[model samples]
Target: MKLFRSKQANSLTELVKACQKQDHQAQVQLYERYKGRLMGICLRYARTEAEAEDIFQEGILKIFDRIGDLKKPESVDSWVKTVMIRYAIDYYNQVTKGQKQLISTDYIETEWESDDYQNLFSKLHTEVLLETINELPEGYRMVINLYFVDGYSHAEIAQLLGISEGTSRSQLLRGRNLLIKKLDLKGVKQHEKF
Candidate 1:
């Protein structure tokens, strides 16, 4: 059975193999191939572009250090993504360690119909939506990104963030409310349910 058929897969397999053997050129190739996508994940977690760059660099270094541990070369993209996200989460936790009180215990209730919001969200440009998400407070942004964007469940988010599930739920709720408010302020009208 062949592991790689496409040129892209062959390239990826070769790159991973070379990286495992400590080939510097292969390391560079791997970084170049995935940097944009990894940087986008970093940006979702980072408050600033500089912070995202730092996370990206750190993740790349970790990837090079652990490239040999990867059992499946075909899953390199997801492995790289996981490494980058873990790095970003660690960075976020370190930066906000002293501000733990910011995770609000009080959950705010908002009338959020997913179907309605889906319709509303479909109308906004990607950049506009991202900007609105970025404007959220750090904790809120993290929960929102992990839950909504990254497709992690509340329990998964709680574990990743070292918080209780209830806290994760609260943060997600508040984050959604805040996003809706910001979108409304930006003149994004909610679709009226018939």
Candidate 2:
């Protein structure tokens, strides 16, 4: 039986083969192809560019080391994404293990007044939003970054932070309210509208 290979699949298979064989040049090419998307993922999970770069390096290294374990060549991008997320969560879990504190329910229950953000994300550049998020206190920043920027659900953030989903949701809501206050106080207006 003649096996048919689509052009993209053939290329991916070749890349995977090279990766499995420890071809440095092929690995570089693969990294170049996905670095931006991967770095964006890293940025969402990380607090700083340096930290994101560190995670990016670690994630790619893991990908290269485990290339042999990837059963399907076409799923490499998704695989990388999953690895990045897991690595991010691992980093967070390690950093926050003993620092997990129960914030007051009164603070968590503070009625947030940022429903406008729900409709305003597309209006603001993600970079601006990220900058605003970076301005948050460490705990609030991490929770919000994972929840809003990384697209992790509350349950996932709760699990990652060793907090309840209620805490995760409250943190996110409070973070959003705080962000809106910061933006408003800074007189920053959205350049575009969602």
Candidate 3:
């Protein structure tokens, strides 16, 4: 396993070097290797399949354009993911610019008991959870995706979305509450205290 891992990393390094030299075949190979994972990132950030495609394409172009700037070839996957996320945010901002706000100032508070929904969430399918998340209001969805799925800090989300850390926290809280309600409507039972 260690040998295979080293070989994989070495191959990736070679690929990055070739891509930096503008080798078309290496670029295609790199794209093919990363496209699926990057597409998943794009899909999470985009409301529609078409929009996701647009984001993915833009992200790929950015990656190609900036491949020479990559300092650590071993971290290429993470760098690619970061690029896709930035492109997704940019695309979202462009699409929603000058639009009515989707985030509500009115906050909902719920007392979450320990291990209250663990079993319920454990029993649910990933697809179901993803669908429920996608149904969230745009701001809620973005916050949830950035915070929960992508493991971005609230401070990072605030910077990404041009909001305060308090707003990011509020949005995350509200998004979770909305998710719980949706899960309840789907017949996932919670503890009586919930």
Candidate 4:
């Protein structure tokens, strides 16, 4: 088992090819290789680790199911990431379906990076920051994850989540404020920045 575990780290191209052919061992290896990355992506969008696990499990299955269609084995990393993100978006859409709050307003741009906050950020840890972000309201969290974490523009997020650009901007602003408040409340206690 130890040797197999070590072996899984080598030969990603071969791993992907074997996975494409539905080899069960290779499939397991592929999962082992990408599980942390897949789960990290899910965690950014999810409210809790459990929810992230649910998304991670679903995304992994989806990734394998479509692996056979992969054109470039070397590109599997990005391919899997794209699929996981899309699936997370689907999960968000389905969960937020009837409860969607469309707040239409001109973009409210507030600078979160004040000099005071910059000092705090310099001492903050990644886990603490992620926890703070996760504490945001569902809509706010989703928009924050999409826009900042996932690097999607407001227009792109609006299109992806079927919300208006104004709404996306609104959510992101609200999310940022909430995150700042949370961070302010929880000052750095022997914490070091990531």
Among the numbered candidates, top TM-score falls to 3
Segments of candidate 4 deviating more than 4 angstroms: 1-10, 100-114, 188-194
Please, what is the TM-score per model? 0.83, 0.72, 0.86, 0.80
TM for candidate 1 is 0.83
Give lDDT: candidate 1, residue 100: 49
List model 1 lDDT by residue over 3-30, tens digit each: 1133587778888999999998888887
Residue-level lDDT of model 4, residues 95-172, one tens digit each, is: 755575544342355466558788767666788788877777777888888787777899989988888999898778
Clashing pairs in 3: none
Q: lDDT (CA) for every model shown?
A: 0.78, 0.71, 0.81, 0.78
User: After superposing candidate 3, which stretches have Cα over 4 Å from the reference?
Assistant: 1-7, 103-107, 187-194
Worst 10 residues of 2 by lDDT: 102-111
Q: Which ranges in model 2 have alpha carbons more than 4 Å from their true place?
A: 1-9, 96-123, 186-194
lDDT score at residue 104, model 4, on the 0-100 scale: 30
What is the per-residue lDDT of model 2 for residues 1-194, given as tens digits with 9 covering 90 to 100? 01122348678779878988889999998888777887887776677888888888888788788888988887776777777778876876776445755453323333445775554554667677667666665567777777765567888888877789997887787776676666553434655232
Query: Model 1, clash count?
Result: 0
Q: Which model, 1 or 3, shows the larger TM-score?
A: 3
TM-score of candidate 2 versus the correct structure, residues matched by position: 0.72
Better of 1 and 4 by lDDT: 1
